[model samples]
Target chain A: MVYLHDGSFEGILSGIYKMFHAKAKIDEGKLYEASVYQQSFFELTLNVETERENAHRVASSIYESFGHEGFKYVYYAYLAEDDSYGTLLFRSLKQAYKIGHQAFDALGVEDIRLLTQMANKVSRESHLLLGLLRFVKLENGIYYAPFEPTQNVISILAQHFEERLADQVWVIHDTKRGIGAFYDKTQYHLAPLNSFESLQYARDEVAFQSLWKDYVKHIAIEARRNLPLQRQHMPKKYWQFLTEMK
Target chain B: MEIYEKLRILADAAKYDVSCSSSGHQRGNANKQLGSTAAAGICHSWSEDGRCISLLKILYTNQCIYNCAYCVNRSSNDVKRAAFTPEEVVSLTINFYRRNYIEGLFLSSGIIKSPNHTMEQLIEVVKKLRTREGFNGYIHLKGIPGADESLINEAGLYVDRMSYNLELPTTKGLRLLAPDKERKQIIMPMQQVRDQMIAHRDMKKHLKSTPSFIPAGQSTQMIVGATDETDYHIIKIAEAMYRRLALKRVYYSAFVPGSTHPAVVERGRPPLNREHRIYQADWLLRFYGFKADEILTPDQPQLDLLLDPKCQWALNHMAYFPMEVNRVSYGALLRIPGIGVTSARRIVNARRFSALAYDDLKGIGVVLKRAKYFITCNGKYCGDGDVEPVYLRQKLLEPPKPEQLTLYQTHPEVFDESEATIRGLLT
Candidate 1:
């Protein structure tokens, strides 16, 4: 059935919950049935509004039957946010309900395989940003890091630095999404950040940046300098924010 | 000297080091410390030379008493010299770490007055970083070759990883290139650190309060192509180090020509290809269960410049060709040229549901371009034409040779500043 949910996580889940019991409850609603599993069709599209209640039921079904591993795949895929990602969540959730945990290992299935790839792409970005994301100390003793990650991975990056850099107050701004994560030494919270104001660097920031640039230059072995390999690890899209690249 | 000059000189002195890994410790921010070590490690940046800038890799000082000819900081050379105070190193590590420019600090030093004194100077920095600053980040300390055992052990308690460079592969290479360092002098501290790590593991089993002893274990590096050591010799040494000493890693650094010392060799270009081939074999030894003798023999003492060790082995043993992927054991699946650890595991897992075909292989992560030469699907051979070794060898292409490009990270005049004319290669 074509059950279109609002693109939110809860809406996606509500859509999946309605799809699973399509034959019974979905027939009376404004929804229209489509082929399930392995290439779904859209004869009709019905927006799902039973969001929170249905979202809770599907989430518990995933946790109870397939364990946390299956939910990780769904959540990361959701974060990846492709154009038809909602339909992907619905199809993979159907896989979880039918085959239970085996759905994860069933890489032969196209939807499951794509979900795995999307989740992996999200994870790879999260891991890369852990190192690539640079923080510039502002004039007021606040460390602010600005980045443009393709995937919505602020949650992952925030949790890592919150524990790793526990004693400092910092802000991680996702400029592309207009959102920011603010951590106040003890805890962190996320809020909308449409645009950023021009901030001055700390007094010693320029001197340290010069020292850092020299270190990066001198540490490279002249015999093995391969810019292609360096670019392969640190791509062109993320160069504007890097202190060394600048 | 200013921190700028000190950093430039010390970092240039330390660039020959190939150990840039910052992993192996899961130490967290205890009592709300300034930093924590990630278990898988993180690379904060990559230099233009295409190597990882994981840590603030630098030397405490570039002033050396012993003249190691292959080293730029050798006493015989008149290069610029500088050193950082213990306070300077602590502050640099904290500031760079806070800016997310580096994961931690990799501190090594030239023998200041003596081996014990240099080791002590290195330890004092880490001691302050850990205790005073409450830094729980990754640390890779250089273990002075002939330092006292007590000092080496105590340094282990403060750092996550320790390494003593086996500067040259064989004793003959040490005599030829770095005459001041003896093979035994380097091995002593490595052995001491290994024994301490073993004792720490056993002690921790009984008492939970036992502090970590180099929880990342010990790793070593050797200069390749500077002297005429065979790939066979280097691989065997690395294999023995892993088996006997329980070392975590062994790095191979291609010698870069940057000194005027008479002992330095390979004046034209670094033998990066030879270094690359040896690393290919090193991975096979560490993960692929291949022995040193299996990779290279006295009959063919060097690795093939064109073929990888695994593909070379596969070509040699054609009897194992055209193996059915679905039926083969996981070990055999790994032996195939295109199937890696991940692809092999995927094939094994996916086959449980149904047999994989050539199309399924690509999705599951097999390099069909290479694997099609050796593997079969569903009792059908998908290899192009006959799987003859000679034809397959011709089909494989090689990477760009090193002679085409120069490693001029800066302009060529960067060398003119030193005026330390390396022999005929770069005149």
Candidate 2:
């Protein structure tokens, strides 16, 4: 039997909860929103609606039974937008339920390896974005930064910026996702911000940006120009929002 | 001059220092502060030259009294000079930091009036940033040679890291290039910083709220390819400083000829390849647990440009190779070519469940092309027949084709065979 989810973490967890209760031989499953679902057919297709209570129970069970590391791998793997990741996590969680924490120790298993790989990619992209995200001061004294990360990493990256820039009001908008993590001086919340027209940068923002561009240009030693190495560290995909790159 | 012009002049003068790391300091933000430092530093941007820009690296003033022959800001040189006031420095640091352009400020200076006066001016900017501005970001202050010990101690309280550049590795080289500077003057302040850090750590063990002192520890820079000092001499000094002074890092800057001094001008531009080799050897010393003498012997005073220090060491000690991957310890795994600290740890972790084959080693992060010659999986060798040292050296040192280079340049994500083979050997 195959189950489908609405491409959300809760939806995926609800599918896992149903799969656990049914105890039927599962063939394959995926996010219904993915384009691949339209080309293929399955015998039984149940649309798993997101259930908050069932999702919470499965999340807590994963943590309680397999430990935090296993839960982290599943969570980060779900955040990875790979189409195969949903099925990979479902199978991995089933194995986790049976073997407990030792499921991750079975490196020979294909599902376990793919789950770890997807999670690693998500974690790597999030960490890189933490360093590459640039902010500009707005006229209202709030710092506004925009990033289009490859993964759904805004939720993770927001916590880092909150601790580092605690005194300032800021917004980290994921342009691709159309969602922004807004941080007032005290707390942070996520909201959709489709339009960027509301941002009014400070008058001296241009001057400060020029100063930074000048500093970056002068700081680089002219004799040792390596474009390949530069691109290796700061990939071309992240050049859009970088003030120095502009 | 305008502030932007001053920034260009001062940053250009300060570019040769090459210490841009903002790590090791874990400064949490106070209630009203605007910034904080992570335990592991963040690189805000990388320049075209592939250097990390973690700090607002600039000099407070470029007007100097000392006539250092190799320095761009030497008093005799006919170049533009500029100085920033304490207020201007503080403003630029906080503003640049807020815009996410830099992690913090790395403030160095040329001797404007005296060592004490210049040190005091640097301290004032940091003091104002911490106390009045409530900025809790990383700050790396340069210690002036011959400055009073009390002044150095005072500056240590405000900054995260401090350094006194030992521009020349040997004392004789110091006298030739920078006649006014002495080796003792530089080493004295480093010793003071080290001792104070030890005392602070001891105090923190007993008291819950002992304020941090130089929480990031001290680092120093040495100009490579300037003097006639061999790699042997330089690495010896670095190793000794790491052991004796408890220095966090020892940066190496290749000497760029900026002055018309006969000694510097005669030896054109410094070879960057030599500097790169030293950095690789330095990594082996710090992280790979290799010693100075082990990297270079008395007969061979320099590193091999063809192969990296690690590969060269592995080739020299061929008897240790062809070990089973599933049974080797983590320390022994690190000594293998194409196996770094990360891959070694991964191999140790992944091997607990199932034995790793040559193909499995690739997934575990080990670069198999290079490791094929050095390692085995379940007592099976995957390398080509005839494991001769001369043949392996030639195979590793062969250069890649231009088309392959361009392919790697265009699509860096796609693994080019030649580039990976070379990187596996070099890095």
Candidate 3:
């Protein structure tokens, strides 16, 4: 059986309704697939538009059993592009209903622990990106940086970068999701940044980078030539966008 | 010229002096400053060497008179030299602070012309930041040895904290390594600073709201493994400093064998693990009420790289183990291998309502693996059956001594799974 639905919260809820009606087992499939969760034994349903009541019923039921913390985990996991997250979310909700608050203790068990750990890890990476991600300030003084992050944490990252580099108008485009956040004057918003190349940056960027590179170079004492030590401190991955590396 | 030039030179020179912790100071807003110093848990940063960069730590000048072999800024090293006038530093500090770049300044210097000359310049920077700039930010200044007592006293009044680095552990180490520096030059200034602080406190008892003078207290740095000095000798010196001088901290920096001086050991840098273990030992001495001789002996001059200082000591004295958790006194609570000050307090607080079982011990954040061998729950031993003293010692120390990773965190990957486990050992 396959349940194909539009990539929306309502559509996913409608699919959940079908699964409940048939009492079908959930299976993993590529999220981007037009037809996903297909199995040979059960009937395949193509559900597109979702009723508002059906989506609300599914969300409220999970919320009733586990309170707010459990709902937040479910919503975040749903938003995560991985299809396996949806199955884990379903299993966690079903188990929580079975055991009540004791199920909340089970939420701290290894499987959910991995999910929280991954979320936390992604959150930390995004925060670091906000600080360390360098923008090539263009001739017109528009600062821009495009990064491909493994986690969909660009939205969280955008807030911190917007606060820190407040004086300038900048753009942090997430290449993985083909979306970007823009901070112009006071307001900030997320919008599609389709054109990856031909992006402009501030003119004095090269000069500033030269000075920064020279600064880091002068500080590194040659007598302590611990490449292993240096690699341990600053990883090769971060060196890609660093001014000194260029 | 530009502030960047001064920062590049001054900060680079200051990196050598490993005493930039914005820690153990408590204060609220007084005059016109923006932030207050915290009592504990101030964040530290990492240099290229991966050391914690807690402050905008910098030298007043790299120019020197005394040539200490263990110091990079010794008189003979043919390195580029620079000096920051007091006003120059004040401007840089204000600018960096405004940019949210640093918590405060950690000012140290080479002995330029004389110790008094260096101390005066260092004093001038703290004074200007305090009175002229109205900067109430956390400032940790290094007191130059052999400087005028009055000069050191005045410097202490303006700075949040001050330190005198005992570069070598022993007097014999001092004579051999740093010929010009005497043991008295370092200890004398610390004594003067302590005397001034005590006198200031005494006057404050009568006067309501007497001004703060070095409210964070004084600290000192000891260069570990620099000479033939053992960990026993190094920790002994630190224990004495903590007890006699009332020092707030005694930082142990592993000798990095890069000093250009002819006298320094060119072969092996001190195992970073040894320095880490010494810090763990130092913590036990301060908070756990453990004595230096109790932690280590001259015969066993080195700390076990595998087990922590407390764990090693507990292994050595297993007859004292299986102390009943419910009835053990607070003094005995401190003696348990895995029980820190926090966990001991937790046990005391939690046991007031209910008797703590083996499970409840975990709730109080005790490591069951280590603590099980030492503590008894409801007067029953939960440790391994083969709990002989020698066997326990071997068990505690046999865990593969994970490689020593430097505490200097410059990048993210320095914390790969294996290295992060090692990093935990060092911090």
Candidate 4:
């Protein structure tokens, strides 16, 4: 048996909810996102429609059984850029149903270990983007930041900024994924936005950016020039939105 | 001067002080707040020199009254000089912070008229950022030597961390390089700050809303290769400071030749390797539970350039090798060359469920190549039944595969401590 989801966190959980209810005995790797479902040995497949209530019920049950850290790992693992995340997360949750919180523990198990690895990678990338994400002030006084993260971590970064910069209105755009998280002064929501090529900057945006570039150029000690070390900390792929790098 | 030109001049002058940490401060945002500091900090960008630009690390003013020979902002230097007004500094901080260009402000300055006056100017910027601008972000204010105790106390209230750079390790080096700055003057402020932090923490234990005073604690920076102090002297001083003063961190910066003074330049290249080794040794002191004397003795003070301090210590003290992975205590597991704090803890936890064989070690995040030689799996040795120091040293220095050494070079991050040292992430 195979279960296909819509490649969203809720979609994966909702699909898992159906799998748990039916108790269908299935082979390994029988679960995947609908977009990534390749023709494998499995013959029977079902595209599980996303059920918001079912997803919420499954998530709360995991939170109740596996603890908060386990709940976070499930979400972060789903956010990681891996095709096996859906299958592994579903299997781990199934294992969690029996073993309780010990499912996140028991690193010797392959499914739990791989799921933990993905969650750690996604969490680490989100933390890095929190710092590396650069913001530009728009003419309308909204703080607009755009970056292309390897993982689907725009929501994590958005939630961080929604608290850190609560009073200021901001928009965080994922250039590669064509999605943006917009926050008003009161609350925040996610929306699709691809047209960020043309932006009206505040009057002093270019001036402050130039000043930042000048400061970066001068603050670096001339004798201690190590581009390789610089790349190791701030990888090359993240330089596009960096005003100083530009 | 224009703000652009002033920023360049002031930032260039302030680049010599190499304390860029923005971690260990946890301040939550209030209602409709503009900023909040994270305990695990956020590094906005890495500079060309490969250092983190956590804060807007600029001097409040480069106009100095004292002519310190090793300082770029020295009164005797012919370089460009600039000073920022209170409004200019406040505006730059708020704007840069809003754009996510920096974590917060790292405001240091050259001595102006008096130490008290210079300290006041630095405090004013931070106070305006906190009270007037409503910023709860991290603020690392550099303390002015010879400043009054009252001023240091007041500044500690508004800032997250503070430091007074000792520059050189020994008092003799201070006398030679920076004649105006005294060792006692620098040490006094550190002592006072440490006392205040202790009192604040004690008060917080009783009252929840005591209003944190330097919640991030104090850290100091020392120039490594400038003076004639060896790694032993520098590490010893760092250990003492960490022990006696309870300093959060002690940053070491290698001397950048040909930039500051004519007499200061001894070689074309700075002693970067030596500086890195000292940082690793310092890591062993702080985290790895190794003593300063254990790292270096007076007879053989120089750390091995090729091997890390932990590996060197493991080689020199061979009696502690072949530690049983399943049965050895967590502290003993940390003594293994390749094992870190994370791996050691993981091994302890994983061992509870099942005995960790050599095959299972990799699953628990152990770097097997480095740990295999020193650690054992259920009393089975990975290298050989018998340990030979000379052979082990040679084998460790050689690349994993001889042929691949020609085809590719291993990244510096392959080893953990050295990477932390160079990247300034040694917390």
Candidate 5:
């Protein structure tokens, strides 16, 4: 059997809720996003609509029974963009509910191991982007930064910038997906980007960027130039948004 | 001078002082403040040499009043010198921070006029950034030796971390290389910062509103290989500093040939590997329960460049090897060469449910190739048949060659799980 739902955390949770209520054997079941569903022979596809109450029940059960760490694994795993992330999370959650919070300690379990690895990838990407994301000052005095992270991590990255840059108006745009987190001093909200038009930078933006680039160049000692080490730390994938790299 | 020229010269001069961390402070943003600091520091970029660019590490001025044999900014050295005004420093910090270029400022300076005067100028930059501009970012200041106790104490209230460079490890080295600076001058301010931090913590027990005093604690830098001090001597001093002064970090800088003085010119550039070994031994002192004496003895004064200190220590103490992985405590697990703090915890927690096999150790984040010689899981060992010290040393000395990438595979990020595991084990 195949279950389909909208590509949201709530949709996945509701699917899990329906799976349990129907008492269906999940050994041969597969989960897929509604937007990318593909039918196969002898597979029964069931569309699961997101129900707020059911999603809340599953989320609260996981939080109350498995503790915060368990919820964190689920949260990060949901952000992973892999095709099999849903099935992986489902299998892990099934084991976690049986063994309680100790399920995370079961690194030997294959399902739990795969779930944590996916979660770790999402978290690692978010942390790296936190440092790699560079903001430019827009002409209207707002800081605008755009990035293309492999994982869907804008929601995680937004909370960090909201706290660190509290007094500034900023927008952290995920260019791959047409969405961004807009912050205006007091509040932050996620909104869809209408267009990918680049903003006009402030007059002194070029000067400050040049100064930063110059500092980066001068700070390195020529006698100890390790391009491989530098590339290892700041990967080429992140160099696109870094001003000094340009 | 233009700000661009000042930045180039000052940054070039400051590149040698390598304390780029902006961690250990957790300051939340205020209503009107422009920034905040996270407890775990954030690196904005990486330089070509692979050092983290966490703060805008720059010198306020490169003009000195004394001649030090090993310093590039010494009075006798012929180098371009520039000084940034208090306003200039403030503007640069705010502008860079606003654009997310750096965490904050790491402001160090050479003595322009006098110790007190230089300390005052450095304080002025931080004070203006905090009060006038309302910027609450991480600031690491260099505490000038021989500066007044009052100035050092006042500066600590505004900054997150401070350091007084112990240019050379021993007093004799200081006397020979930097005659103007004395051991007493450097130790006095470090003692002051340590005492003030203690007093502030005591006061905070009674009063809830006592402001922070060097919230990130103090660190000091020691130039290795310049003075004939052995690794044992350097690690002993660092251990004492950590135990007595409550130091946050003891940075070991390899002596690079910068000064053209006859004394410095005689000593060629020190190998960077020596500096790397000192750092590994320093880590054993800080995080792991290993002591300086345990890492290196009087007879074995130098660290083995080919093998890590922990692995070397394990090879020396072969009697304690082949311990049961499931039975050892967390501390004992850390003494293993390949098991770090994180993996040790993972092992301890994961083993509660079932016995860990040799293959299970890898999933728990242990480096099997290194730990195989030292640990056994469920009475099964996968290491070589002959665990002799000489043979094991020969086997471990062969560093793994870098794997060639294929056309489809891309270079992995530094924080990739495998890289992070290797770094955690080594560091």
Candidate 6:
């Protein structure tokens, strides 16, 4: 049986809480977008309200079975925003919980190692995006930027950019999940920027674009010309909004 | 502060000095500090040049007294110059660090006023970072060539790493191009720091309370292709730096052809592949148990610009190839062109489990393309068993002739004898 829950981290947690309370040994892979799973199997559209107490218990269970770091490992991996990560994380957490805290120490084992490695990948990707995110100066004296990060770490990235560009009003739109953060001098939040494309990007965006393009061209030396090396360092897919490319 | 303008200028100037590896100092935030530096090093970001920008790699000042002809920020260049106050640098380091943008600082500077004066400013920046700011991050401070030994020692106490760039590779090149600087002016200060570090370790062994100097050790940068000094000369200097001074690294910066010095060859820059080959050669000397003289001689001193130093060495000594993968010694496995430290270790470990098959060689991380040319699996020749040195070399050189390769594949042509013969014809 497959359980379709609202695509929210808390909602997914609540589903896990319900499964545990119901004593259901449902496979982690059972959750699908309705098309892929077996048709005759039981399907539940879970609307379990996100209980703080249940979330805490679930977190506590993982910590008790693993450790404090293990809890954070699962949390950040969940924050990775990849749907596939959910099943992998769930399976790992379930297996670890079943075996207790001793299983956490067996990190060299492949299954547990995979989760730890995934967590590290998400953490590193989040850190790299901190420097790579390009902010364009908008016409209204605001800085606007967009990113399609593979992990749900846009908020963590926004905090650093916000501090660095504190003087300006800006918005960073995470185009993939339609969520973003807007900072107007003193405040910021992860809000739905669904209509961000229509929301006018400032006029000076063109000037900043030219400046960055000029910077990249002049800085990349011809004597040490290595485009394949450059691509290996900064992949081409990242060039769409990087002012250096345009 | 005008330091912002200076920061851009000096940081840009310091960018090409490639000794910026930030490994080997791991300290945790012990005093309730917000962040800590790792011993294995951390790369926060890579710059547009595709080089890792882990530290705040900037010059304390670009104001130099020495006019090194190959340097862009040579005193003669009428460029916008700037200097950072020690306080300003401290704040910038902390602010950038708090935001997790950088691991720490890589503070180098031109000879601002005098070597002692410049060394003082460098020391002051680190003093404030370590003592005043409560910062325990990895700092790599460049020692001024003519700085006072005491000042250099003081600077060493606060920094994680220190370097004095041997701007040109050879003494003759140093005289012809960078006339104002002498070889001793650089090496003397490095020797002082290294001796002090060793003395500190000895003191610590006796007196438990003794402090260390530059825990990550010292590294130096040599500007490649700036003078007539060949790869053999460059690697010789590197080996000397490691053996004599105990330098942790010897960075090779490929000279960009902007200098109008008469001694410089202006027809075309020495290929980046040449610099890459030198670095590979340097690694072989430092870690892979090869000597500078063994890699190249004064007669055949320059590295073959097409094949890596290891592969080039392997080619010259073809009798060592086709060794049994399961039985070859760890040191011998490292000499194989396709085998690295990682694969060598894997081969050593996996051999205990089972006699490795041809398929198992792939799992052990051998470059099948390169290793097949060198090794045999259980006496089964994976590559052409006869190992014609001419035919083998051609296959290796053909891949990147259309487009240049990375620092890793710098001298792809050096891999094959036929390619070398072809190139000799064209030249």
Name the candidate that leads on DockQ.
Answer: 1
Per residue, candidate 5 scores C-alpha lDDT tens digits across A65-150 of 88898888888988887778777777777777777677887887778888888898999889888888899997899899988898
**What tens-digit string does per-residue lDDT give for candidate 6 at B33-91?**
43466666766544456666577777778888878778877888877788878887887
- Candidate 2 C-alpha error for residue B68, in Å: 1.8
In model 4 chain B, the worst 10-residue window by lDDT is B400-409
Q: Write model 2 residue lDDT over A1-246, tens digit each, in one string.
A: 566777878888887887777774434543343334554453556767789999899999988887888888889987888877767777777665666565675565667878988989998988778788999998989899998999999988888877778888999999899999999888799988785766788999989999999999999888777878999999999999999998
Model 3 chain A: ten consecutive residues of lowest lDDT: A25-34
Ranking of all predicted structures according to lDDT, beginning with the best and ending with the worst: 5, 4, 2, 1, 6, 3
What tens-digit string does per-residue lDDT give for candidate 5 at B272-367? 988998899999999899999999999999999889999999999999988789898989999998888888888988888788998888876677
Across residues B43-156, which tens digit of lDDT does each residue of candidate 1 receive? 989998888999999999988888998888899899998999999999999999999999999999998899999999999999999889989889999988878999998899
What stretches of model 4 exceed 4 Å from their correct place?
A24-29, A39-42, A97-99, B260-265, B384-386, B398-427
> For candidate 3 chain B, which ten residues in a row score worst on lDDT?
B41-50
In candidate 1, residue B56 scores what lDDT? 95
TM-score of chain B of each: 0.92, 0.92, 0.89, 0.91, 0.92, 0.91
Model 1 accuracy (lDDT, Cα):
0.85
Worst 10 residues of 1 chain A by lDDT: A28-37
Error of 4 at B403 (Å): 16
lDDT digits (tens) for residues A1-246 of candidate 3: 455656666666665665565665434321222345554455544443567887788888767766776665555555455655544544454445655643443422334544444444664555445434656666776677766766676776566545444555778878778998998857589998785557554554554555445444554544444566656645567666655565
Tell me how far the alpha carbon of residue B64 in candidate 6 is from the true structure, in angstroms, after superposition.
2.2
lDDT of 2 by residue, B96-121 (tens): 88877889999999998889999999
| Candidate number with the higher DockQ (4 or 6) | 4
TM-score of each candidate?
A: 0.92, 0.93, 0.65, 0.93, 0.94, 0.71
What are the per-residue Cα lDDT tens digits for candidate 1 across A1-246? 456556678877787777666742322233222232233464446667856998898888887777788778878878887766766666665554666566777787777888889999999999999999999999999999999999999988999999888999999999999989999989899999977668899999988888898899999887677999999999999999999899
Q: Best candidate per lDDT, number?
A: 5
- In model 1, residue pairs whose N, Cα or C atoms come closer than 3 Å (at least 3 residues apart or on different chains), thus clashing, are A1-A34, A225-B49
lDDT of 4: 0.86
Residue B209 alpha-carbon offset, candidate 6, angstroms = 4.8
